[model samples]
Target: MKRKIRVLVAKPGLDGHDRGAKVVARSLRDAGFEVIYTGIRQTPAMIAEAALQEDVDVVGLSVLSGAHMALVPKVKEALVAQGMDDVLVLVGGIIPNEDVPALNAIGVKGIFGPGTATQEIVDFIHKELAEPAA
Candidate 1:
């Protein structure tokens, strides 16, 4: 039987605001994913470690402090270090439109900005996991 998609939704860096992350976590859970939410202030290393330990299929990072460029690459690096690059990485939270290309270049599959629907994020995960590995 196919296992349900396992996702790690994490808040990285010093951002104390968590209402958005919590809402997405809840939404993904309701959408039938096994959501592992690591609460606030998790470093990139901590998140990558947790993702590896949990053996999740996706890593979703929510950063609202305008540090998406710095945080997203660090998380990707950590995933590479752990040989978890096969795990899809998605980032959301206040990302500027100009920064989307750079995020994609660094292996981010989906970028969810403000006003992006919760179902869109969930659907992205579904479609990404369905693709055969490169």
Candidate 2:
């Protein structure tokens, strides 16, 4: 049997808000993906370490502190340092539209803003991870 997709959902930087993160974690779990939720106030290093230890297929970051430009890349760097460059990275919450392209350029596979459907996230993960890497 194929292994279930493992996802690490984290709140990076000083984002004390966690309702969205929790909701996404629960949604992913209900959709049959294994999810690990690292709570708020997590540093990028802490998140990367959790992803490595959990062997996650994806790292879902919830950043609402207006620090995406700074925090996301650091998280990506940490992941790469852990040799997790192949892992899918996703971001959600409070990201400006202008910054989306840059985030994508750095390997964030998807960015979901407020009011995005949970099912869309589930489907995105399914489709992205289902495809063979190019």
Candidate 3:
């Protein structure tokens, strides 16, 4: 049997705004996936630790402190340091288009911004994980 995808949705840095993260977590849950939400104000190391402990298939970070550049790379580095490079890293919330390429270059596969439909995020993850590995 194919196991359900486990996702860790986190709010990193000093961002207190959590409505978006909560909404997406609910949406993903409704879609029948397992979601672990880490609440708010998480550091990169804390998030990485949670992801490893939960053994999640994906880590979705919500950053609105304009620190996406600094935060995302740190999280990615922690994941790699923990030997969890296989986990897919995703980001969302007020990210500038210019930062998108850099985020991808640092190992984040999905970068959702404001106005991005939850369905799109859900669908993308589904399609991405469904592809056969070469």
| lDDT of candidates 1 onward, in order | 0.92, 0.95, 0.93
- Candidate 2 residues lying further than 4 Å off, grouped into runs, are 131-134
Cα lDDT for residue 51, model 2?
96
Compare candidates 1 and 3 on lDDT and give the better one: 3
Give the C-alpha miss distance for residue 126 in model 2, angstroms. Answer: 0.5
Tens digits of per-residue lDDT for model 1 on 19-93? Answer: 899999999999999999999999999999999999999999999999888888999999999999899999989
| TM-score of every candidate relative to the true structure | 0.95, 0.96, 0.96
Instruction: Give the Cα RMSD of candidate 2.
Output: 1.7
Question: Model 2 Cα displacement at 108 (Å)?
Answer: 0.5
Regions of model 1 farther than 4 Å from truth? 131-134
Question: Candidate 2's C-alpha lDDT?
Answer: 0.95
Q: What is the lDDT of residue 92 in candidate 3?
A: 90
In model 2, what lDDT does residue 44 have? 92
The predictions' CA RMSDs to the true structure, in order, are 1.9, 1.7, 1.4
